[model samples]
Target: MKHTKVKDLLNSTKPVDDVLVKGWVRTFRNNQFIALNDGSIIHNIQCVVDFENTPADTLKRITTGAAVAIKGDLVESKGAGQKYEVQVKNLEILGDSDAEKFPMQPKKHSLEFLRENAHLRVRTNVFGAVMRVRSVLSFAIHQYFQEKGFVYVNTPIITGSDAEGAGEMFQVTSFPLNNAPLNEEGNIDYKQDFFGKETNLTVSGQLEAETFAMALGQVYTFGPTFRAENSNTSRHLAEFWMVEPEVAFNDLDANMDLAEDFIQYVIKYTLDKCEDDLKFLDQRLTDEEKQKPQAERSEMSLLNKLQFVLENNFKRVSYTEAIDILKNSKPNKNKKFNYIIEEWGADLQSEHERYLVEKHFKSPVILFDYPANIKAFYMRLNDDNKTVRAMDILFPGIGEIVGGSQREERLDVLQQKITELGIDEKELWWYLDTRRFGTAVHSGFGLGFERLVLFVTGMTNIRDVIPFPRTPQNAEF
Candidate 1:
């Protein structure tokens, strides 16, 4: 007999005979009732067992975390919470879990505790809902691009150019660290490295995606990106995924529009598709916040927060305007901010971003025309020569969810920027070719996928959204 998914049976309109269900036992109650879950849905299907007829030895094996199959009659649940229940006629234990040793038992767990037990975290309700929503969001991302006829481009994972120009990329080398071959300059000879040149896990796929955008007209890269930054903040993840979409003949405004629309579409799609999971997360967040001080808690629930993004247009403001607003804001005036905004050229921090979104604008915000010195080299230079055609999308809780810019198409200006930054010209010859050969106006943006998931799932920490998080010193399953 085909094994019936718990999700499908829970939605059944009528009774079914001898339905087979296989799942890990969530809990065994009264030696007669079992809560079984297969991760197909957030809720578990109760399986009523025949304790009188069943052997006591077999009954002892139906412990939490144990894998079991039940052949039962699906009937209307007598319990108040669920709609359906299974009257088990046959039971078989496929695998027995040591109840004493299983890390993920039915209980409230700290996020840090679950992080330590990531391999088994999904067995918990919180991780299950988060991961389910994550899967739906990922599908929505690809679906959003594919439906729009955008070419899906797979950029090289090992790349030579630092797209962000942040110098925080993790170096990739096959040579043993201590025994690397050296040249006369007393530096490791990268020419002898695996790629015949120094390479690192890509920080961004924007540069490579731009090359494809020139030919394919529109292209996007959804892949893993790495940053070697050692920041231990909840929002920072050394290894995360990025969604980079590049479009030819697109100016900065068009880039901003594409980003806003793409994000809203995927987010809306996820919200619609993962209703149950999102609801679970919303309740989970509400429950978690009850322990926090009122001032520190989120003003809106997760569902409302997501709906707010979908309902409102992102307020577009320039960097100078944002600086002015932040400078006069209560935090800056009262010296409440950790990093006060004193001038125009300083980069905005998360606190400032949240202030703009949740306090000032009370909506999603987009601040454009950032200082050239602070942005990457690829951004198009403005007439003022001090700012670039760059923009960032800031959300209420998650600051700077998206970063993008109108790419510099002029070879001379780009080379000048590269030279001024002391970047190796020889290394970026291929990227320069796009400008050299028919580089029309082009623009693109990169959305941190994990950050998006964090926002959509109402997860405060970026690590909680991704399955296996790789931090500065911690890389475990």
Candidate 2:
């Protein structure tokens, strides 16, 4: 028999048609109504099952969260709230779930408890919405780059260089830890390791992607990256996905434009394609009505601002300008800040980032040309010799979703920066060779896919945005 998705059944104009729908039961209301969803839509179709009319044998087989196939005739019902209903003719139990043991219930569950049940959280409405938005946002990323003549390049997960140059790396080896290569001092020798030298999971794919961009003109890498930083923040994870797009012959301004356009594309796509999911998230997770305190109004206001951002252009500002605005604010404001937003050279924390984009700017902000000392080594130095051509796109709530810069094309300057930054020049011969062979001006940015998903889905935690998130102290399936 042909199967009809539950969502299609609900959205159809003809309700009185024969339909077959299968899904795990969300809840059975009053033993008469069954709300079933196949993870196909934000809303579930309510299958009105009259237990009195349903065969006694079939009724006995049904349970909450159980996989069931129902052959039914859809009917238009003028119920109190529903637009359509299903009249069941036959019920087949595909699988039975013990209601008592299942993690989800009709009542609300805390996000923390749901985190512990990563495998089962998708069955919940909030998580299902997150996964759906995550999917559309990812598709939009590929769509934006492909339309702009950018070739999709897959970079290696294992690497010899740290693109972020942050020094957080995870080692890879075929040998067991107990019997690995030893040095003269009897320590585990990285020189004689499996890859014949020190190697670790790549922190970012920017450097390798830059090589491809120089050849292909424009290339983007979308893949997994690892960091062994042991950070346990709600935003940091051990393993996550990133999209790094590098373009040749681009400067800091071009880099900022690309970042802004790419973000606008994703936001517009998610708003257009995942309307139902976004509405669901906006209602349940980010609604002002759901906040517990009046002080939390700004948090909800940020959501409205994000929605408005889709229809508006982002604001561009230099680091110096942002600092001046912060310095000018009154010493005592109505809303005290969690972290101070200071002068140009200081790193912008999340609190400062949120305030700039969400409250002060009231729109998305692109802060460019960060101080060279605080940024990575590959960034091109401005003529002033103080600032680097680095750019960060700060979104409300998420803060710095994209970090990028124009690469130093001059071999001498790059080599000098490498040495000054304490990075080994010999280890990056292939990277430097891009300059030797015929280097062109290039720029790229790495957008943390999880953070993008959180921004798109209105999810408050990075853990909820990623499936089976690999955070510190948690690797369970």
Candidate 3:
């Protein structure tokens, strides 16, 4: 018999005579009702069995986390929770899971406990919903860019240069740990390495994406990026995916427009396509918040928060204005902020960003014109020479969901900035070549895919949204 997915079976209008369903058993309750899920959707289909006629050995094997195939008749469910169910006539245990051995039982598990068991955590409702939403959000990103005639570029994962100029990078080498080749000066000889130079996993695809954008007109790269930052916070990940779009002839204004539109479109796509998963996550968040104090609770539900983002325009504020607002704010004046905003050139911390987005603006904020010294070298320098045409899109929960800026197209200015930052000029000759030949005003931004997923799924920790999170001192699967 052909297998029918639980999603299709549940949405079926007419009853089927015979159906074969194969999935992992979520629960076998009362030795009669079996909850089965095949990762097709968030909800599981109930399979009612005739326990009296069934063998005792077969019933014993129908435990949580057990994989099974059941041949049954499809019929409308009379149960309170679901719409349809399978009346099991035959059952085969494809894989048996001992109830005492399986870590995920038919009960709620803490997010931290689930993180430890990352490989099997998706079987649970929360992880399943989050993963599904993450998949849909990825598709939406491709869809939005493709529809706009933007070419999708797959940038190299291993590179010989640091795109972000951040010194923290995971070195990719083939040398033996204890027997590495050394030069006459006792320095590690990278020339003897595989790439004939020092190489590391790419931190961002924006620099490479810009090369394609100049020729292809507009290009976007969605791929894995690695960072060696040792920060073990809820927001930082050693390995994460980045969605970067580089557009030609785009200034700061056009870049902001693209960022705003892209964010809202992808979020709306998830809200429309992953209705069931979003609903489950929404309820999950609401239940979790009940344990916290009234003051710490969220002002809006998950669904309501998503809708609010779509319905309202993000508040656009300049860095100078934001600094002014923060300096005069009660937190800074009362010495409540850990990093007080006392000067104009001071970088805004997460606490300051949250206050602007959550407390002051009460909306998603797009902060632009950041101080030049605080931003990357590639950001366009303003005429005043004090700030850059950089922007960061800050969400209510996530501090900075998207960071991008207009590129410094002028060859001399870019080279000077590179020199000023002490970046190796010889290492980035290829990137500099883009400016040497017909450089036009181009802009791009890097959106941390996990952070976006964290925001959309209402997951608090950055680790929860990503599968097999790699953090400092914790790479266990």
Q: If scored against the real structure, what TM-score would every candidate get?
A: 0.99, 0.95, 0.98
Candidate 1: tens digits of C-alpha lDDT, residues 38-103: 999999999999999999999999999999999989999898998899999999999999999999
The window of 10 residues in a row where model 2 has the poorest summed lDDT is 330-339
Q: Tens digit of lDDT per residue, candidate 2, span 364-464?
A: 88888889999998999999999998888888777788888899999999999999989899889999999999888889888999988877777777888
Model 3, range 251-293, lDDT digits (tens) per residue?
A: 9999999999999999999999999999989998999899899
Please list the Cα RMSD from the true structure of every candidate, rounded to 1 decimal place. Answer: 1.0, 2.0, 1.0
Candidate 2 TM-score, C-alpha based: 0.95
lDDT values for all models: 0.93, 0.84, 0.93
Stretches of candidate 3 above 4 Å error? none
lDDT for 169 in candidate 2 is 93
Q: Global CA lDDT of candidate 2, please? A: 0.84
Off by over 4 Å in 1: none
